[model samples]
Target chain A: MKKIKVFTNGLIKENPVLVLVLGTCPTLAMSVSVINAIAMGLAATAVLICSNAVISLLRKVIPDTVRIPCYIVVIAGFVTLVQMLMEAYLPDLYDMLGVYLALIVVNCIILGRAEMFANKHNVFESALDGLGMGFGFTLALLLMATVREVLGNASFAGMSIGFLQDYKIPILTAPPGGFLVFGCMIALVAYLTRGKAPIKKSFDCEGCPSAAFCRKEGKACGTAETEAK
Target chain B: METYKLLLKIIMTSVLVNNYVLNKFLGICPFLGVSKKIDQASGMGAAVIFVMLLATAATWPIQTYLLEPNGMGYLQTIVFILVIAALVQFVEIVLKKFLPSLHGSLGVYLPLITTNCAVLGVTINNITDGYNFLQSMVSSLGCGLGFLLAMVIFAGVRERMEEADPPKAFKGIPITLVAASIVSMAFYGFGGFVTSLFGE
Candidate 1:
């Protein structure tokens, strides 16, 4: 039950990009094409998952004063590791993502999770939070990419489908198009779900019997306010 | 004469032909954030230009000496961000201690520059464009001035926009975005002119 809740939280309820509004910089900049979006999303997810796991395991040892810097070092370490491995293995995706790959270290999402959840949680829960949040981010990227690529490039996932291929809006491919499309998507999501029976987020477990353990799983905590409202 | 041509090229490229805001979309956060007021727009622009120039100066040596030779190229993002963050902090402290007046003017924006992609973008631009120290400095200056130019111009437009009645849905950010689109199209006019002038 707990695991399923964690997984679904990232998909819809506590989506990192849409709900939390974290990591807008990369989400806005890199979603120019479907390929770039996926590559950026996957790279960030890999870093987030690994860093969260590692931070969870070492949560006890890292002092609070240096926690932010410590997480950065860990994140940067994995970022470098992922970057080199990508360059060596997936040279093509490496080229596409280019500098943005390294920019993931300041991505806010990874560091946000590290500070907010991973540093406090146990290994299992932290890993779940990472997966859920990572997937949530990827989902947002894909959503944005779908709009940008479909309207701008007139194709989805590289295939020239339907009348949309020739239906190129031209502006959608450019910079302003990225912002306009993203803004609309965000508005739609907010309008639709803002007033719905809000999904009970996990972080609400505070003062409950399992607060200690669930604290590690940060997903539940964020929606607590909404749940109360 | 060669240096003059490079300077001319940098100015032309950075201003209209490949504007940091309209064309490259580098510093749109502040562009959108602070451009509502003309005075604030220029203030933000000047601050950005100043920080950008200094950042280019600082990051160039760090890249040349540290990242390339050590094969820590992969660490570029993390290293550059840390350097920029630290630089912003240092500048804030120094301003508070020495240039209190200037600090008061720029303090609100100092913390904002840490995440401004344009700062990082310019440094990254130096690396990828293979710009040496001097050229990078020139490009940074050009980019900053271009940012200033865009902000000032947009502020002028927005000042006028306040008087005009607009649709409910597109009143605030939406209309500003539309105006940006128009400005972006206007910038496209500079492309051909700049290319012809440079003969590139």
Candidate 2:
């Protein structure tokens, strides 16, 4: 039951992209098409699950001082594996993902999970956490992609929606559209969660994954409150 | 002259046309996080620029001489990230040791850049774009400068945004995102400048 919570927490309560706001780069960049969104999400999930389990297995062996580097190596190895498999089997999707696929090495959600959850949990629990977080990330991507693809390209997953084609919002397919859609989705999530969307109080080092290692970890660093005054 | 022109074009394209932050969405975390103040933004930007140049310089040779010849191209992601992580660490230690004053301002951001997609993005982009070592160096510098430009300008805007009373829902990141969208829209004007200039 508790393990279930660990898994389900990533679904909504702590959705990586929506709630945690970890992997926004790829979340915004690759959600232009539904198929790309799904492919990116699944690829990330494969890496997440594999890395989480591996990290969990080696959690004890990996020293605390070098854990971040270790986790990154592990995650990047899995990402390369995923990249190779994709290149060989799904060249089209592979091409579509492009640099973003490689950029998954730095996806905060994957690293955040490795640091926050996977390193501390058992293998089974870590795997479940990865699945849940991966699914949540995928769900958020799917939602954004659906809106973006339908409005931007007037298509769902490459299939043209006849009526919408005439009224497509070209901006929705661009960078600005990515930001707008992502912002609105964040707002929607916040509203649905009753303004409890883990809205970061500030953009300081506090929220940074490396905040623990920061020289000024405890004190206020980059808060708007401090800067505004 | 021809090679120099090509290098200049690559720099311009990376800086304006395909900005790592606004256009490519590479380093949104730091773009949004460190943009609260011009000083912090610039500090982060300098650190990013420093790290980006070093990472690309290191990775380009690794990819060309090490990975490509050995047919270990698939190891690009893992190897590049490790290189970046180590590079950032090296930078941090060097700064702390030799330039403690500079480190005092930028040290906090150095560790953060290890996981920053922009650094990794620039390196991978260099490989994918088929840029030679010198071209990759120039492009990485330009990308870093572009990120600095966005960060400094966005920081100025955000400084003003503090006074404006936004709505309840759009108070924090939502409004910032909206503002970023507008900024991104403004950057679109530069999208065609490269193509028109280079005839590509």
Candidate 3:
């Protein structure tokens, strides 16, 4: 049950995209289309799981002072692996993902998991957390892509929706639309959870890798109070 | 004179049209997370500008001279990131030892920059965009200036947003994101302006 809970933690409760809001760049950039979004999610997921498992296994071996860099080196290696395989076999998707696939090395989700969860947990649990978080990322992308591609483009996975074609909101496919849709999605989630979401701990600066040298009393990532008040 | 015009066009386009944060969706984390205070935002922006310029200068030579000749183009991602990570560390140490007052302000943001996607994005983008070394530097400068512009502008916006009270749910990041949506729409208007200014 505990292991299952670890696996299910990211599904909704700690959904990385919506709830925790870790990797917003990839979540926003890649979710314009269903296929690209899924491809991005899975690629990042593969990197996430492998990195998490490896980091957990090597947690004892890595020094405390340089752990973040070590985690990054590990994550980058896996990302490169994914990049090569995708380029060779899935060239089209490879082109579509572009710099984003490479940018996954800087993704907060992978680094955040390594810092917050994987380092302290066992290898099996860390991998499970990675899987759970990866799916959560994917599911959020699918949700946004459906809203965007269907409403914005009047298509589902590149297939035109005959009736909805005339009623599309084309702006949803543009860059601003990504921000608008994501803002609305996050608001919807916040409302549904009645602002009681389990986001307080992870909502702060911990998830960001730069927090390693943050001199701002753990508030380097700008808390809500600081931003609005 | 023609070369100067071309460089000016690249700067304008990157700063206004293809903005790193607003358009390209790179570096949204710092754009969103650190823009609350004008001072901090500018500090972060300055650090980003410095690192981005340095990263581009470092990576371009490595890509053109080292990787291209060796048939190791596939190693770009790994090599670039490691170089950036090391470069950031070196900058931090040097700044602290040689320039304490400057470090006092910018140093806080340096560590956070290592994983900031925008740094890597600019470096990789400079290469992929196929700008020669000098062009890459100009584009990166424009990218950094654009980022700084966005941060300073958004800091003012967030200050206004703080005065308005939204519902309970849209109070924090959600509302901030929605505000970003509106700001980005405004940025979209710059598209036509940049094209006309530079004659496309």
Quote the chain B TM-score of every prediction.
0.96, 0.97, 0.97
Interface RMSD of each: 10.2, 3.3, 4.1
Model 2, residue A169: distance off in Å is: 0.8
Candidate RMSDs in order? 7.6, 2.3, 2.7
Identify the runs in model 1 with alpha carbons over 4 angstroms from their true place.
Answer: A58-60, A194-229, B25-31, B34-36, B152-193
Top DockQ model: 2
- Stretches of model 2 off by over 4 angstroms after superposition: A204-207, A215-229
Top candidate when judged by lDDT against the true structure: 3
Cα distance off (Å), candidate 3, residue B4 = 1.8
* DockQ (Cα-based) for each candidate: 0.14, 0.57, 0.54
DockQ of 2: 0.57
Which segments of model 3 are wrong by more than 4 Å? A200-203, A215-229, B192-200
Compose the digit string of candidate 2's lDDT tens values, residues B1-200: 99988998999998899999999999999899878879888888988999998998899999999999999988888889888888888888898899887777777677768788999999998889888889999999999999999999899989999999976766688888888998999898898998899877
Write the number of the candidate with greater lDDT, choosing between 1 and 3. Answer: 3
RMSD after Cα superposition, model 3 = 2.7
Model 1 scores a TM of 0.81
